[model samples]
Every structure is written in C-alpha cells, then in structure tokens.
Target chain A: MGKMELVDSDGAKLSSALNRIARDIDAVFDVLLPVPDDTRAPLVEAMRYSAMDGGKRVRPLLVVATAEMLGVSRDPALRVGCAVEAIHVYSLIHDDLPCMDDDELRRGKATLHKAYDEATAVLAGDSLHALAFEILTDDETTPDPFTQAELVRTLAAASGMAGMAGGQMMDMAAESADYDLHTITRLQQLKTGALLAASVEMGAILAKIPREGRSHLRAYARDIGLAFQIADDLLDAEGDEEKAGKALRKDDEQGKQTFVTLMGVEGARNQARALVDHAVGHLGQYGEDAAVLRALARYIVERDR
Target chain B: MGKMELVDSDGAKLSSALNRIARDIDAVFDVLLPVPDDTRAPLVEAMRYSAMDGGKRVRPLLVVATAEMLGVSRDPALRVGCAVEAIHVYSLIHDDLPCMDDDELRRGKATLHKAYDEATAVLAGDSLHALAFEILTDDETTPDPFTQAELVRTLAAASGMAGMAGGQMMDMAAESADYDLHTITRLQQLKTGALLAASVEMGAILAKIPREGRSHLRAYARDIGLAFQIADDLLDAEGDEEKAGKALRKDDEQGKQTFVTLMGVEGARNQARALVDHAVGHLGQYGEDAAVLRALARYIVERDR
Candidate 1:
C-alpha cells in the first residue's frame, strides 16, 4: 500500500515534503510585514529566532504527512501546517520569556527576549500568535474558507484557555502544591495534547474527512500528544544537555511537576511506551498508509533527545 | 431624504434599532446558565468583568448601526457585534496585565489581574479572546458559514499585528523614543483605527453593502479613528478622572506623543471637529438611515470622557 524508502530511516530524518513545508512556513511570516521596514526588524528577528531555531518541525510534519497519507496534495495542507508550527513557535517564545519560563537558552541559542528586550520579545510572541491564525484563515490556496474558519476556531480553542492556557495555569499553581499522576497527565494533555490534537484535526479539516475518520484521527493525535509529553519528561530526566539543546532536569529545579515527578522515572518511561503502542495500534485502522505516523510515534519514545 | 428627529440635539442618539441592538448584544452575553453552576461560575464572572467593564461598546455599536443603516435585520449583526466586543475586552485585559501595560485600574475598578491573580487574569483574557471568534464562527448562526469565515479573516487581521498589534508595538516604542506627529497618527490608526475601521467594514460586510459603499464606510472609519484618538488625547489633557476612568493626562507624563502633543490642544481639537464633519458627510451618501452613525461620530469626539 506504500513505499517504505520514501520514509527516511536515519535518526536525523529530513523528508522532502517536511523541508518544503518549513520553507513555505517561513515565507508566510514574510507576508503582511509592517512599514518603515526597520520598525519590524526586531519582530522579524525574534520570530526567526523562536521559529527557525533548531528543532524538528514535528507539528508541520504531522500536518503534511497526514494529508499526504490520505492521498491528497500537500499544498493546501502545507499552509495550514505552517500555521500550526507558527502557533507552536509562538508558544515556545512566550514560554521562555522573562515573565513566563525566563529561560536563557532554547535549542542551545539565546531565547528571544534574552536576545532582545522583554517587551519586544512579548510583542514578537503576540504577533506570531496572531499571525498563525491570520495565515490559516487568509490562505488563498485553501478551497473551503468555511473549513478554514473552523480550523481557526479549533486551533484557537485548543491553544487558548480551555487547553494551553488552562494547562499553564495548572502548571503555575502546581508549582507550590503537590499534584498526583492524574493531575500531571491532565495538565500535559492541555498544554501539549491540545495543539497536537488540533494539528491532526486541522489536517482532517483541510482534507474534508468525514466525521467518523475525523474522530479516529483526533483520538490518534490525543494519544500521541500525551505520549509525546511523557517522552519529553523522560528525556528531561535522562537526556544530556548538549544533545537535547537545553539542560535536563530543569523542571525539578523549578519545582515543576511532570510525568516523571508524579510517577517514578521507570514508571514514566513505561507509560510513554504504552502510549506509543496504543497510538500505533490506532493507525492499524488506516493500514499501511499510516507507516510514517507509526514511525513518528515510535521515534518520540526512542529518540535519545 | 432626512429626519432631524433621528439626530438628537444633545448628541447623535441611537434610533430604536440601534438601541435594541445594544440590548440584544447584552442578552448574548447574558447566556442562561443556571445560578451557581461550578463550571460556568469562573467563566461567567470573568466574562462579566471583561465585557461589562465599559468603554461605550464602540466597535459593536459601529457594527450594529452600519448593519441597520444598510437595511439588514439587526439580529444577526447583534451576535457579531457582541463577538467583536468580546475580542476588544480580551485585548484590554491582556494589555493591562503586568506583562504588558501593568495597569492597575481600568474604568475606575481594579484590572482583572489586580482583581484576580495574574494566572487567572491571563487565562481569563485568553478565554475571552477565543470565545469571541467562537461565537462568530458557531454553526448555529444564520449568517452563511462562508460570510462568517470572511468575518473571522477580517477580525483576525484587524486584531493581529498588521493592525492592532502593529499599533500596540508602535505605542510601546513611542514611550521610549522621539516621534513626530505622523508617527503618532500612524500608531493611532493601526492600534485604534484598524479595529474601528474593521467594525464599520464588518458591518458593511454583514449588510452585503456594495463594494464602493463598503470602501467609503472604511474611509469614514479611518478618518474617525484618527479623529477619535485625537479627541481621546484632548480628553486626557483636560478631562476629569471621574469621567475618563483612567488617570487623566497620563500620556503626557509617560512622554507618549498624541495629536494633542503634535497639534497642541486647539489644533488637535480642530482636527477632531473636521474629522467628525467628514464622517457625517460620508453618512450623507447613505441618507437619513445612517443618522445614528453620523451622531455616533460626533458623540465619540464630544463625549466628556
């Protein structure tokens, strides 16, 4: 049902579609720039730092790969995919700002606000956040504006209070209090799972998938989102700083609760494996076409950093 | 071709459709949730604080008045108006946060972060922002889904960097450096004017006004947005805190330039008057039906606050 060679096996995998998607995403940022070109330099620079910095373009990969696997052209989905990545980058920029996480380094580079003033960093984050939806809603290539609008609403809801913001609040409150495994899982679901779910949901939306397939895709994303977060926690507990691009176990120093904190290190690892297995099983419903998605889930758990 | 009664001698008073439209806007906010429901309590309270905080609901008013003046039923426009107001309130809450403006008082009451904790405040602002578009894009609405989609694109652009955020960035930068009158005017246009223009533009859109008329409406809004900002600056210079709600003349202390700073009090006042006249002139093309919109512009300039 599929060609395996098209899927890269190397740890540093770079699919052609993924690379094109990244470039397309960068191009979207170039649109709608402010005048007096210098005024927008800081904004453009900070967004570049946050977005173009070294990290796998996983969210965008998910968007394009899913669309391709569904036997559709990737162009329309690519724009939406890039928009998703923009939102992800915006989140990371804000999360690392002085008022939020206050981290100095991201992907082994100085964080956006650390490189610039706090206010500029904040505006850059806000701008990127807004740009994400603007790109999705205003994409001329998308055939169905109504579907695009639904995608905007879906991403907004998942990325906003009921999801990411709620998780952030929980994370902040839990800093001073003890939280159990379930509480930690719920927070992770909101913070990470919400966007990931939206990624798949958006792909389905752009593909015009029927309701039943959409539900399964959503479930697949939900499982992967949690699995991905668990893998991240495990990596933070056991991975190396040079390899991971940031220090490991900083969450402990911050008194932040994660899957590793709520459960033992071994327990967290086991949970991640279980989730990956579960997510991959759901792909069975889609047959061989979901091969890349299955591999992606496995990579989340197995990757050293 | 005209009715003097439609224009209040004291101000540009609203006709019945416009007044009913405002009530209708409030009713949407007053969703019939059962008393003391735990899930909605926080959201409802936050919505009340954010929505009812009061700034004349100018954007919504523009939308409703524009729709009515174009001979559309006020009902559909009412929902959109409320949605725009929700977005406006959300932006204000975030703008007042410690991370942003760090304002303590708004409309003579403690800002959301001061009233609640910073985390709740941030989440509340985020929720309201998401809720705004959610209301507009809801499937239950009678407006065609495609039109709703277009509205999302328009509102998102107005609220995002190329519009509101662009204005905000300029405003923030203006505090630190020297700026000319053109710079100040540009900032005001992007920050306040973009949304104001969008308000009228969206109304024209909802009414399905002819493209030329819509463009004229936008031109009217552009002029009025600057005029409105000049009036605001004038008010800040001379108005009382009891009426203005915010501390009067803070812009001067902050070293922020305004039309008043660029044009002096009298010059800025004259510019505002001219803008009002121009706005009314545009309404003339629409005749007596647009009397409420004409009056609203005058009121925007002449209001004590």
Candidate 2:
C-alpha cells in the first residue's frame, strides 16, 4: 500500500510498473508451462526453475510498458513479453553451461545447469527456445494469425545467427583473442542490445506499428539498449553491486575486454548517462504515455542492477 | 532420363521422389543459411556443414511428397521441408554434444562439436533452431499469415517440451532408470514420432486439409514412426549396418531394453512388418496419390541403412 503511494513519480512509477509486468508475465509463463508431472517432468522443472522467480524481467517490462503505452492490452503484450523472456532466459541457461561460462550462480541461486545436470539444462534451454515461438503462435497470444507470425519472426531474428546466438559465438571467440572497443561494442550490441530492442519492437509489432512510424521508438530502444549494457559493464567493473552479482564479475580477472575496460570506468558511466539522455530525447514526440519508457531509460543508467 | 522412366513402381517412384525432394530442400537451405566468410563465418560454416551434405532427408521428403500428392506447389512445400530439416539437423547437432550422446561421427564424418569446438556447436544448433522458426514465419514460406502461424505452432508443438525436446529429456532419464515398453514407446513417440507426424501434418496443413481429414494419414505416420524405431532397434541388435549407427549402438552395448531386447529379435522384426502393413492399410483411402507414403512405410521396415 505504501509502495502504491510512492508510484506517482516517473522513477517510482516505472519501478512499480516493472514489478507489475514481471508478475503478469510470470503468470503467463506459469499457465503455459504449469508444473510438470508428465514425461517431461525434469524438463518442465528445469524450465520453470530458470524462468520463474528470477531476474529483473527487463525485457518483459519493456514489452508490456511499450505496448500498454501504444494502447495494446496487457494480455497480448504479456504473451510477447513472456516469449522474449524465454529467449533471454534460454541464453542465460546456455551461457552458464560448463563449456561456456561455467557459471554456478544466477539471480542469487544456482544456475540451471548447477541445479539440474548439464543435459537437463541444455534441453531446458532448448525447449524454452521452442516454447517462445509456440506462445507467439498460440491463439491466446494473438487472435490474428498475421500478428502472431510477425511476433515469431521478430523473436527469431533477435535470437538467431545474426543476433543473440551469433553474438554469443563472438563472445566466446573474444575469450581466446583480444577484442578492440569496436568489436566488443558490436558484440554486446548483438549479444545484449538486440534482444532488448526486439522486446520494444515486438510491442510495436503487436500494435501494428509500421516501419515508418517506428523510427523514434527504435532510436529510443537503441539508445537504452546500449546504455543498459554500458551500465552493466560499469557494475561488473565495480564488482561491488551485491545484487548485480554473477558470472560477469570474473571477466576482469579473466582479462576480458568490456566497455569499462575499453573506456575507463568513469568514462563508461558517463557514456551510459549520455546515452540515457539521448534515449529520453528520442521519446520527445510521445505525450504523457511515454513517461514509463523515459523513466526506464534513466533507470538504465541509475539502477545498481 | 532413364532414371525418370524407371520410376514406374512404388519403390522406384518413391526413391526417385525422395532424391528430388532432398535436392530441392538442400537448395532452400543453401539460400537461407548461405555460406559466410564474415565475423559469424565459423558459426555459419558450422551450420552449413551439419545441415548440408547430410543424411536421408526423410522429413523433407515426406513434406514434399505429401504436398505434391495434394497438388500443392513445390515452392512453399520446399520451404516447409527446409524448415523441418533444420529441426532434424539441429537435433542431431545437440544430440552429438559431449554432455549428451557425445557421438564423434555423423553421416560417417566427424560431428560438428568434434570439427569445431563444443561452444560453437551449441550456438550453431541454437541458431538453427531459431532459423527453423524464422523460416516458418517468413513471407516466402507462405503468403498467408494464418498459414505461417499454423506452421510455427505445429513445429513448436512437435519440437518443444511435450514433443521432441521432452522426449529427449525422457531418453536421458532412461539412462539412469529402467523404463518399461509403454514408457519407451511414449518416449520414442514424443522423440521421433512427433516430428515425423508433424512433417506429414505440415503437408496437410499446407494443403488446407482439416484435422478430421488427416486421421488415416496420421495413423500411417504413427505406425511407420514406431516401425522405423523398431527397425532401427533390430538393426542395432544385429549390429550389421555400419552407417545406421551411433547412439543406438551404444544403447545396445549398454544392454538397454530396446524393442529388439524386449520383444526378441524375431518378434521385433515381425512387429515392424506388421506395423508397415498396418501403415499401408491406413493409406487405402487415397488412390495412387498415397503411393509414396505407402512405399516409405515399407522402406522403414526393410531399408538397410
């Protein structure tokens, strides 16, 4: 009740909205996945374990907030929201595998591979990938099949070879060979930024926003996406954010080239702030409805996590 | 020219048709995942390596053959065929991962993970999975958005937790625990049968054949899917086919209770024959149009590789 009163400011409103979006999207996940007692019990368990009760739900928040701002209902937005989160969650699950990052902890708990075995984790990540497309195409997600098809295309483009997965391959390559700032930036843009931007774009797609009508929104997403990564690099460099903690903390120890390493920590933080400002400027055409997105842009730079 | 004239009977006709479908489907795959010499070159290379120059292309054959039988054009059918083959290739890539079956050989060549590293293999498989969904929803696959959505949904359902991936989870669990005939049947049904059925069902979907119209066709798929596995088990039992190899051979070595092990070799062979007969019986409703499917069922039982 007290938190509800604090939601009047743009900053607090975005926070409250994010929390609400997380819960709503999570409900959608629960309904789709349920509790696995079937032959896929371990897989269902693994999927539920990775997707539920986890993370900041930033991708879902962007989808819901953007769609709601564009006059789309929470239901369809949440469906796409959950779908994008599935892609994000799966990347995390796979990225944490032993052959990859070998992470033990994620979102303050053991990573899925640690919680389950490597095989279950891999399969769960994969099933989640399939489930994302499944939800986008399901009737509940969109009564219009055309809209559903677009959602599938958008999610796939963001997750595929030229997007998230390709970015990951580059990331692994960087582990063996030193990368310059341009290469690292390009890598993170594909790795982290593409999916984030896709979440907003999917929201726009659900509302049938045309390509010409989406330039400003696309710009806003691009700015915020990069800003989010820069802030993340700063946090990982700091290595003191109690909650922003996980596998990335060891990147510096591993001599990996991150944004903070390429640009000094202060410079990286400033770049994030500057990008956040640009991100907010890109939303100037929208009215009061754009307040949540504006606050989210600022939050990208300001949040500890 | 002589080969074309030789396609008079069911066996020769189906064999020639299968070869044609494989070539057409491979061409489609070449277009979608074109060879890359860029930064994502290795990932693209890995993808092309596994998906191209490959196995029997049975799934794509089913799609094309069924679609042609129904008088559907070749382009869309081939697109769907390529999508289905993407699923099959991705499954093989992941199955050969060190954490899973860890097979070093596939199609009598070194597996993707063996040729490249394990991480590239994982990303390549993941990207291929995304590409499958991408192709299903692509405009070239079908101009009708509703049809595209149906394709996406069908592929997802056949590949996700309740489908192929879930079946794989059960398979992994079976390694540590004993499963009876019913459990193994259900497992393989989900694992192998679901996708095979989906390939046929996708053809029907492309031709706008409603669910009720597809009953006998589905029955044929079920019978042949089971028979295919039984024949595979029999092959493994005999340990004679050098190329029809990998995972099942290890299962036999480990004393896994396959169909041949449980039913006895002669009994399993009889069951496979009965299943092929039943599969052909299910095709009686169609005229000469169902000849390829009927021949394919028999081929499932009798093929050496």
Candidate 3:
C-alpha cells in the first residue's frame, strides 16, 4: 500500500487508481454527510447530490498517491484524500451557482443549483466546506494534533482569498478586463494551482516530511498544475462535450482570454506536454516508488476529459 | 485581566466592554483581510467591507469573556473571538444573498450583495469562511497544537450542516411549513444557538477546562442563545429599523413562523427574560468573577438592537 505495489506506470493502472479513489471518496462522503430526518434534510441531500459522485477526484488521487509514495498508510492517505476532494467538490458547487458561473451542467448532470434551489446549493457548498475541515481536524483523520492543525491551515489558505476563491474572482474579472499573460498565469496559479499544489503539500505534511524535504514535490505539483490547466483549456477549446461531461468553449463564449486563446491550441498543447515531462522528471529521485505519480503527470495531458 | 478585578458587572461596565471588544475585533479583521494590490483586491475589499466595523461583536465577546472567566489570556481569547466572528460574518453575508433572504440593508448599510455585485459577495463570504479556520489553526492563535485542533473541530461542527447552516435550512422551510413551537425552537437551536454555545465552549477549550467542568457554562450558553433569538424575534416584530440597523418586520411580511409568532409578543418577551435569568443563574459558582458573563446573559434580553 505504501508504494502502490504491483501498479505500473501505465494509463491502465492510472485509470484503475482514479476509479478506485473516486469510489473511495464517494464512500467517505456518504459517511460524512448523512441526510438528517429533519428540516435540514434538504441541505444534507444537496450536499450529497454534489459531493457524493462526480468529477475525476483528481485532488484526492494526488493526495493519496503522494502520501502512499512517501510511505504513509492507506487509511490516513485515503482520509486526507477525501478531505481535499470535499473542498474541490464544494468549490465546483459554488462555481456553478447562478450568481457565479451559472453553469447548468456539471459531472454529466444538472448543477446543484439546478437540482436543488440556489439557497440549498449555497448551504450545501458551505456545509461541505465545513465538512472538509471537520474531517481534517477529527481525531480519526490522524492521531497527531500537529498534523491536523497543519492540514487545516494548508487547506484554508489554499481555499480562501489568496487561493481558489481569489483566482475565481480574477476569472470573473477576466471577462471584462484585459488580462495579460502574466496576470492570467497568476490567476490560474491561484485559482487551480493553489489547491492542486496544496493537495501534494498536504500529503507531504501527513508523511511528516519537513518543509525543506517538500521542495521537489512542490515543484512536481506546480508543473502538473499548470499542465492540467493548459490541458483543460485545450479540452474546452476542442474536446467533445460528451466526453468532457460538461459544456465546452466557455472561455470563447465568455470572450475570456485563456491559455489556448493566448498561446494558440498548438502552442498550448506543446507547452502542456513539455510541462508533463518536466513534472515527471521531478520524481526521478524516488525511482520506481514514484511511478504512479509520474504516470499521473502524463495522464494530466493525455486524458480526454 | 483574568479576574476583571477593577471592573464591576454593571450595565455601564458591560457597555464599555462590548465597545472595547468591538474595536478589538475590527482591528483583527483589518490585519487579517488586507486588500492586496491585484485582481483579488475587490474580493478582499468586499470581505473587509462586510466583516469589519459592523455588528455587535457579540460572538467574540462571548469567546473572550468565557475564556477570561477560565483564566485564558486576552490575546489568544481575542484571536479566537475574531475567528468565531469571521464565521458569523460570513454566514451573514450569505444569509443576505438574493437567493436567501435577499436583504438590501444590514447593519444600517447596503448588504454585501447590494454594495458589491452578487458574485463578489459570494466569494467574499466564502473567503471569510476559510479565514475563520485559517485563524483558528494558526500557531499565533494558541501555542498548543491540541487547542488549535479542538478549536477547529468546535467551530466546524457549529458552522456546518448540524449547526448554523442546518438551522438556517430549517428557517427556510418555516416559510412554507407549519412549524410548531417545538420545531421552531429546534430550528433556532441549530441556527443561532449552536454558534453561541460554541463561543463559550471554545473559551473553555482554550483554558483546557475538562469536558465535565464545562456543563454549567454550556447551560449558561444555551439559555442565553435561546434568549438572544427570542429577543431578536421580538425586535423583528416591534423594534425600530433605524435603531436595529436593519429592516425589521420581515418575519411578519413573509408570514414565517418565529418565536414571536409562535408564543405571542408578551409570551416571547417573558420567556426571553426568564431564560436570561436562568442563564445568569448557571454562573453562580463563579461568583463575582463571572460578572461579565452574567451581564452578557442579561444583555441578551435587554439589548434593543
């Protein structure tokens, strides 16, 4: 479990791992958010609707893969993965709200606000947000109080004003204001890169890796985060809507400048591939133990959705 | 500072303490939410606008007063207070959204969504929610990692589906459902009571008070929490908008069931007074040192706004 034994650095293994982690995460959410037999039932139901099954569970996979590579036990790794996934799911729910992206479709279904009302959607996102910290701070997540505190701090900072939400604010602004390449890069780093990087950093923290020891992991995460966003831009630009499971060409529709818009599809694709290779290179020190992580990096660019 | 040796538990002294704590909470927000010179500036600005210089700062006062009663230091108490207040303010921002209460005025000024756009308001609320956990888990909040983890667990539980948010969901249902007094009481307990109780509980946690030792304080908080809500219902039924600093009588307009509606104005007023008295009674063991907490309980029923 510590080294992902028997798993090869191939697309098949990565796909299986992704599927496994997705199911694991959904199970965790089921335990975390039971609908009460009371007036609050709808709120918990909405939370479950959005959080239980959806998305690639990429953040959770990142956490578990990184932790397992670093010799952490599977139980703790999976719990940490669930915590990160909860935050990711909550963000998606909020992002799809009418006042925000106003997206009707997500994860191949109507968004939370469409399935429930806007109020329930808002509360559901909030409850899931709280649930993430709840899971991280619970004694069962990890016995070490220090690790719990660190996890809470890391996730909160990444999700707040200077991280995902801030990045989203910048994205909202991009529709009206002209953003240069640097500003857009910064925005993407905050919006998506922050949480992605945090997912890896949290695994390192759980493994008791010192701050200095995390530099390579941080670098690996940074490269893949950028690559992931680039690939997302490419997907939004040209990937099939059915395969992607959501709307595409949104940046174009909104007239927002994206990596694809700024660098052209060919330029963006080349950049993303280069980043994937560079990211995989960072894991060379770990040899075979980092194989899964290496494959994850490649999968970022190769995945159709 | 722990004993409040020089101050008596008079109304004037309580008034001064409230004002002092209000300023202290504002100062903390000023430092915690500085607007960066970037695209995220508007988001931070909106957070600052909503989180600072408003409300009674009652939650923080509860934290500080309770912690001080148990001999916790002022600095840490203030930090914890700020953390709880952050959650409270964030909830207010979301509660006032168009999809929720659709409030135009709050604390005598335009609500966050009215002052800024709906999207900014949502992000600002979300950022502050993250900020609360960020503050709670910071080493500066407490030297003890255990205390940090405990604080996070307490706040998250009180803020999530089973606490404030859950209570809010019940309130939403009251608009259409025929809520009896029992259901309304249960709703208020989750909505406002949980956070209020947590404020006291957090102070006890900071002081390392054993769980058994916190029963009296918990009782005190429960009584005050209900009294606070009853007082709110009373104000909504008959209080002035200018004095209350928000639109009142919305409960009557919406035809929602509330304490006042369920128990009649006189019955509700008497119940609040009785609860305040009972709340103060729970502090008898603390003697003169519990003066501030007792005053707070009394103030819950007596405050006009």
TM-score of each: 0.90, 0.95, 0.96
- lDDT for A233 in candidate 2 is 82
Where does candidate 3 stray beyond 4 Å? A1-9, B1-9
Candidate 2: where are CA atoms >4 Å away? Answer: A1-8, B1-8, B245-248
State the DockQ of every prediction: 0.46, 0.81, 0.87
- Per-residue error for A198 in candidate 2, Å, reads 1.0
Task: Pick the winner on lDDT between candidates 1 and 2.
Answer: 2
> Taking the tens digit of each residue's C-alpha lDDT, what string does model 2 give over B1-305?
75334325788878887788768777888899875544788999999999987788888888877887888999999999888989988999998998988898887688999999898888999999999988988888888898888888999999999899998988887766678899889988999999999999899889988889989878988998899888878877675546664544677666566787778889999998999889889888786888788778878888776
Q: Against the true structure, whose TM-score is highest?
A: 3
lDDT tens digits, residues A228-278, model 1?
A: 998898888888788787657878888877888778888988988898878
Error of 1 at A166 (Å): 2.0
Number of clashing residue pairs, candidate 3: 0
The CAPRI category of model 1 is acceptable
- lDDT digits (tens) for residues B161-229 of candidate 3: 989999999999988998999999999999999999999999999999988999999999999999999
Q: In candidate 1, which residue pairs clash? A: B12-B295
lDDT of 3 at A69: 89
Task: Report the Cα lDDT for candidate 3.
Answer: 0.90
True contacts kept of each: 0.42, 0.86, 0.91
